[model samples]
Target: MAASSQGPVNGVGEDKTSVRRQSEANRKLKYISLAVLVVQNASLILSIRYVRTLPGERFFTTSAVVMAEVLKVLTCLLIILLQKRGSLRAFIKLLYDSIFVQYLDTLKLAVPSLIYTLQNNLQYVAISNLPAATFQVTYQLKILTTALFSVLMLRKSLSRVQWVSLVLLFAGVAIVQVEQEGKQKETTVSSGSQNYAKGLVAVVVSCLSSGFAGVYFEKILKGSSASVWMRNVQLGIFGTFLGLLGLWWNDGPAIAEKGFLFGYTPMVWGVIFNQAFGGLLVAVVVKYADNILKGFATSFSIVVSTVTSVYLFGFHVDLLFTLGAGLVIGAVYMYSLPKAASPSSSSSSSSSSSTVSSSSSAHSRSHLSNSDADSETDAFLPKSVLVK
Candidate 1:
């Protein structure tokens, strides 16, 4: 009788313990995800800063980009191999079978991949010419451009709050640019105006390309059941091809004169690896978290990068620049908020909650069965013992 009585109690205790364990596990996972994002962002910033300090007439931008693409491809291939249990024959067979369809689908993404590669090169140019903090701040303009592209390509409509946030974002970026220009005027740096103009143009083009590529990539992802890693492999394959073409177009004569990888160095390899791995880290974060979390991560990274730049590179941060950065960060947060709950969504949530409650009640009933059996057994016991 005592054993039966304790059965339900112990079961409930076990359930509670499991719930607590799961909750703690989830909290730890969130922390780990955030740390990955922060580290990746810091690595990217440091790599770019290192690259900008290199003294050379040759940037090796094309070669670095191609190497990054190749790294991505190899990383994806490694993942595939692991998934196939190290069966090279199976991997080769799968690749051969999917070659035609994958290539066709990859071609669709290739155009945007090429655009993203160009944007990547432009980012290097902007960072080389501008302070890291300033470059980071200006890159936030991509959010506004992305919204524009979503409207055009995805037929998505924005709420009034979203539109207001975009406007604030734009204003904030403009203020930062003005502050940079004023500082340039006061410094009397050689070719300051020309370099600033070039940086500004590169930033704008990068934003436009990023917006289009992001929206197009989203569309592709939604249209297919391919895994994220698979899609990345396809993009990397095409990106490598496009990088080769770009290298030939921009550096063919130069390569002939100086040979390939003339400007290569350990630092160059560091930059390439950082860029490639950073992208993979982003994919991992996206797989584990929502876009809202991703946005927060990026905003936090911007703040960290800005502060680090001030300390390490002696970046000037005036009142206007601070205000602009604050506004931009605020806008990003506002933009990431979920839209007002629609009636349909509310109703669905209500139904889901009801279902959950029903399941919980059913589970409780199941647990009470042992107690019910105990009660039945208690009926067979003496009345004095049951009271005890």
Candidate 2:
């Protein structure tokens, strides 16, 4: 009896140790991912703005989109291969099974992939036409759209606070637009051909597409056992094909004259890699951190972009822009806050509260188990609200 008691005590102690270690590891990862996300979000936009604004031969945006897709595909493939412990046979078989054997499922990604590709192209258009700071502030529209779609498609419940946040977000963007229009009129001659109207339209459309594609991708992920990287590979495949088609349609003549990489420069290459890396970084951030932290990173990124724009592009932020940006940032943080436990759920478990508590404790200990890793796909999607 003494020996058995000691054995049980030892097991309990070990479990506690394991849980503690896992928690610490996750905490570190959460912060690291958050940091990287802030940098990536800011840098990608700034770099794109820099490249597009340069006065030399402009690189073909369509070709850049296609190249981004190709690089994304290759990067995802390499990650999957590494996951298979460098086993080439295993990697090939897994790809064949996921991409070929499961052809129907693979085809489902085509819709979102196409939308994503278009959204990517539109981003270039928007950035070229608008100031980096304004674009960043306006791009938060994706969060509002994502929440709306989540309610409609996923039937996800949003707290009252979240609803209010959405309203504030829209109002903020509208204010920014109003101010931007005024500013554009003043600087029209000085600002060259930058078109506020064109950029506004492109960004709005991009936000819509982003919202739909992200939710659609999340729906596919929830019902499947495939890893996020695998789905990315699937999306990448379709994206590459769609991107090439877009390239042919939009920039075929230009490419024929100047070659595929016509105005390619080192900075252009950097932007491509930055875009690709940012896409993959989203997966890691989603895996380690929740949407709330991601929102904080986004909020920080906006601030970074705004500050950088001031120095680099001589962006002038006035009272309206500041007020509007502040509201948007606040909305982002509020929207990301976790919904409080519903009274119904609380009441339902009231009778067995003690039992529930014990079970929760047990779950806490086992939450970092392999099963949790397998279910990572549920959080892997590029969700602006839940997964982003």
Candidate 3:
């Protein structure tokens, strides 16, 4: 009897040790993912802003978008291949099965893929014209759009706080737009084809597309059994085709005269790689981070971008822009807060508790799925790293 008791105690101690190790591992992942996220978010915007503002032969934004798509597809395929234990045969079969065998399901992704491609192109248009700091602040409107679409498309209910946050988000973006418009008129000198009005329209439309595509993607994800990387592989395929079509339509004449890769430079290549890597980073963050943490990363990134912009681009942040940016940052944090669980009545407390426990288990299983759906909507933009 004494021996049996000791065995059980030793087993309990081992279990505790295992749990502690797991906890420590998770904590490490969370912080590391957060740091990477903050850096990726800031760098992508700054790089894009820097590249677009450089005076000289500019790389074609349409071609850059297409190349980014190509790189993304390759990256996703590599990931899926690794998941299949580096078996090329297995990877090819899986891709063929998922992409070709399941034709209808693959076709469904075409919708979000097209929208994402358009959203990505709009990103260059917006950033080229708007200041990086201004674009970052204004781009948070995607959250408002996402929330609205979540309600309409997914029939998801929002809390009172979330609704109030959305209103504040809109107000903040409006204030920033007003300030930008005023600045556009006040400046007499030409700022190298910078058009605040065009940027404003582009960003607003991008936000709308971001929201719809994100929610639509999420809705479809809920019904499917595919992995996130596999879905991305599908998106990359569609995005590449759509991006090329766009390139032909917008820059056909220019490309014919100067080649598809005209004006390519080392800086241009860095930007393309950064954009592609940002898309992959979103999946990592979604895996290791939660909504609240992701929101904090985003808010911190805005501050970093704004401060960097002031030093790098001599960006002047007036009082109005400051206040507006503050509001947007706050709204983002508020919106990410989880809805408080309602308390159960005393009479049925035990039963309610049991039900809640079971439901929470199910929710945890689906948590990653929900986060992935949300991330892709902003993947190329910034919400994900920006476009994610």
In model 2, the Cα lDDT at residue 39 comes to 81
In lDDT terms, how accurate is model 3? Answer: 0.80
Any residue pairs clashing in model 1, and if so which?
none
**Model 3 clash tally?**
14
Screening candidate 2 with a backbone cut-off below 3 angstroms (N, C-alpha, C), the clashing residue pairs are 383-388
Q: Which tens-of-lDDT digit does each residue in 265-287 have in candidate 2? A: 99999889878767577656666
User: Per-residue alpha-carbon lDDT of model 1 for 111-192, expressed as tens digits?
Assistant: 8778877877788777777777777778888888888988999899998878998999998999998888887755446534
Best by TM-score: 3
What does the lDDT read for residue 12 in candidate 3?
65
Candidates ranked by lDDT, best first? 2, 3, 1
Q: Global lDDT of each model?
A: 0.69, 0.80, 0.80
Q: What would you estimate as the lDDT of candidate 2?
A: 0.80
Arrange candidates by TM-score, descending: 3, 2, 1
Which regions in candidate 3 have their CA more than 4 angstroms from the true location? 1-3, 187-192, 339-388
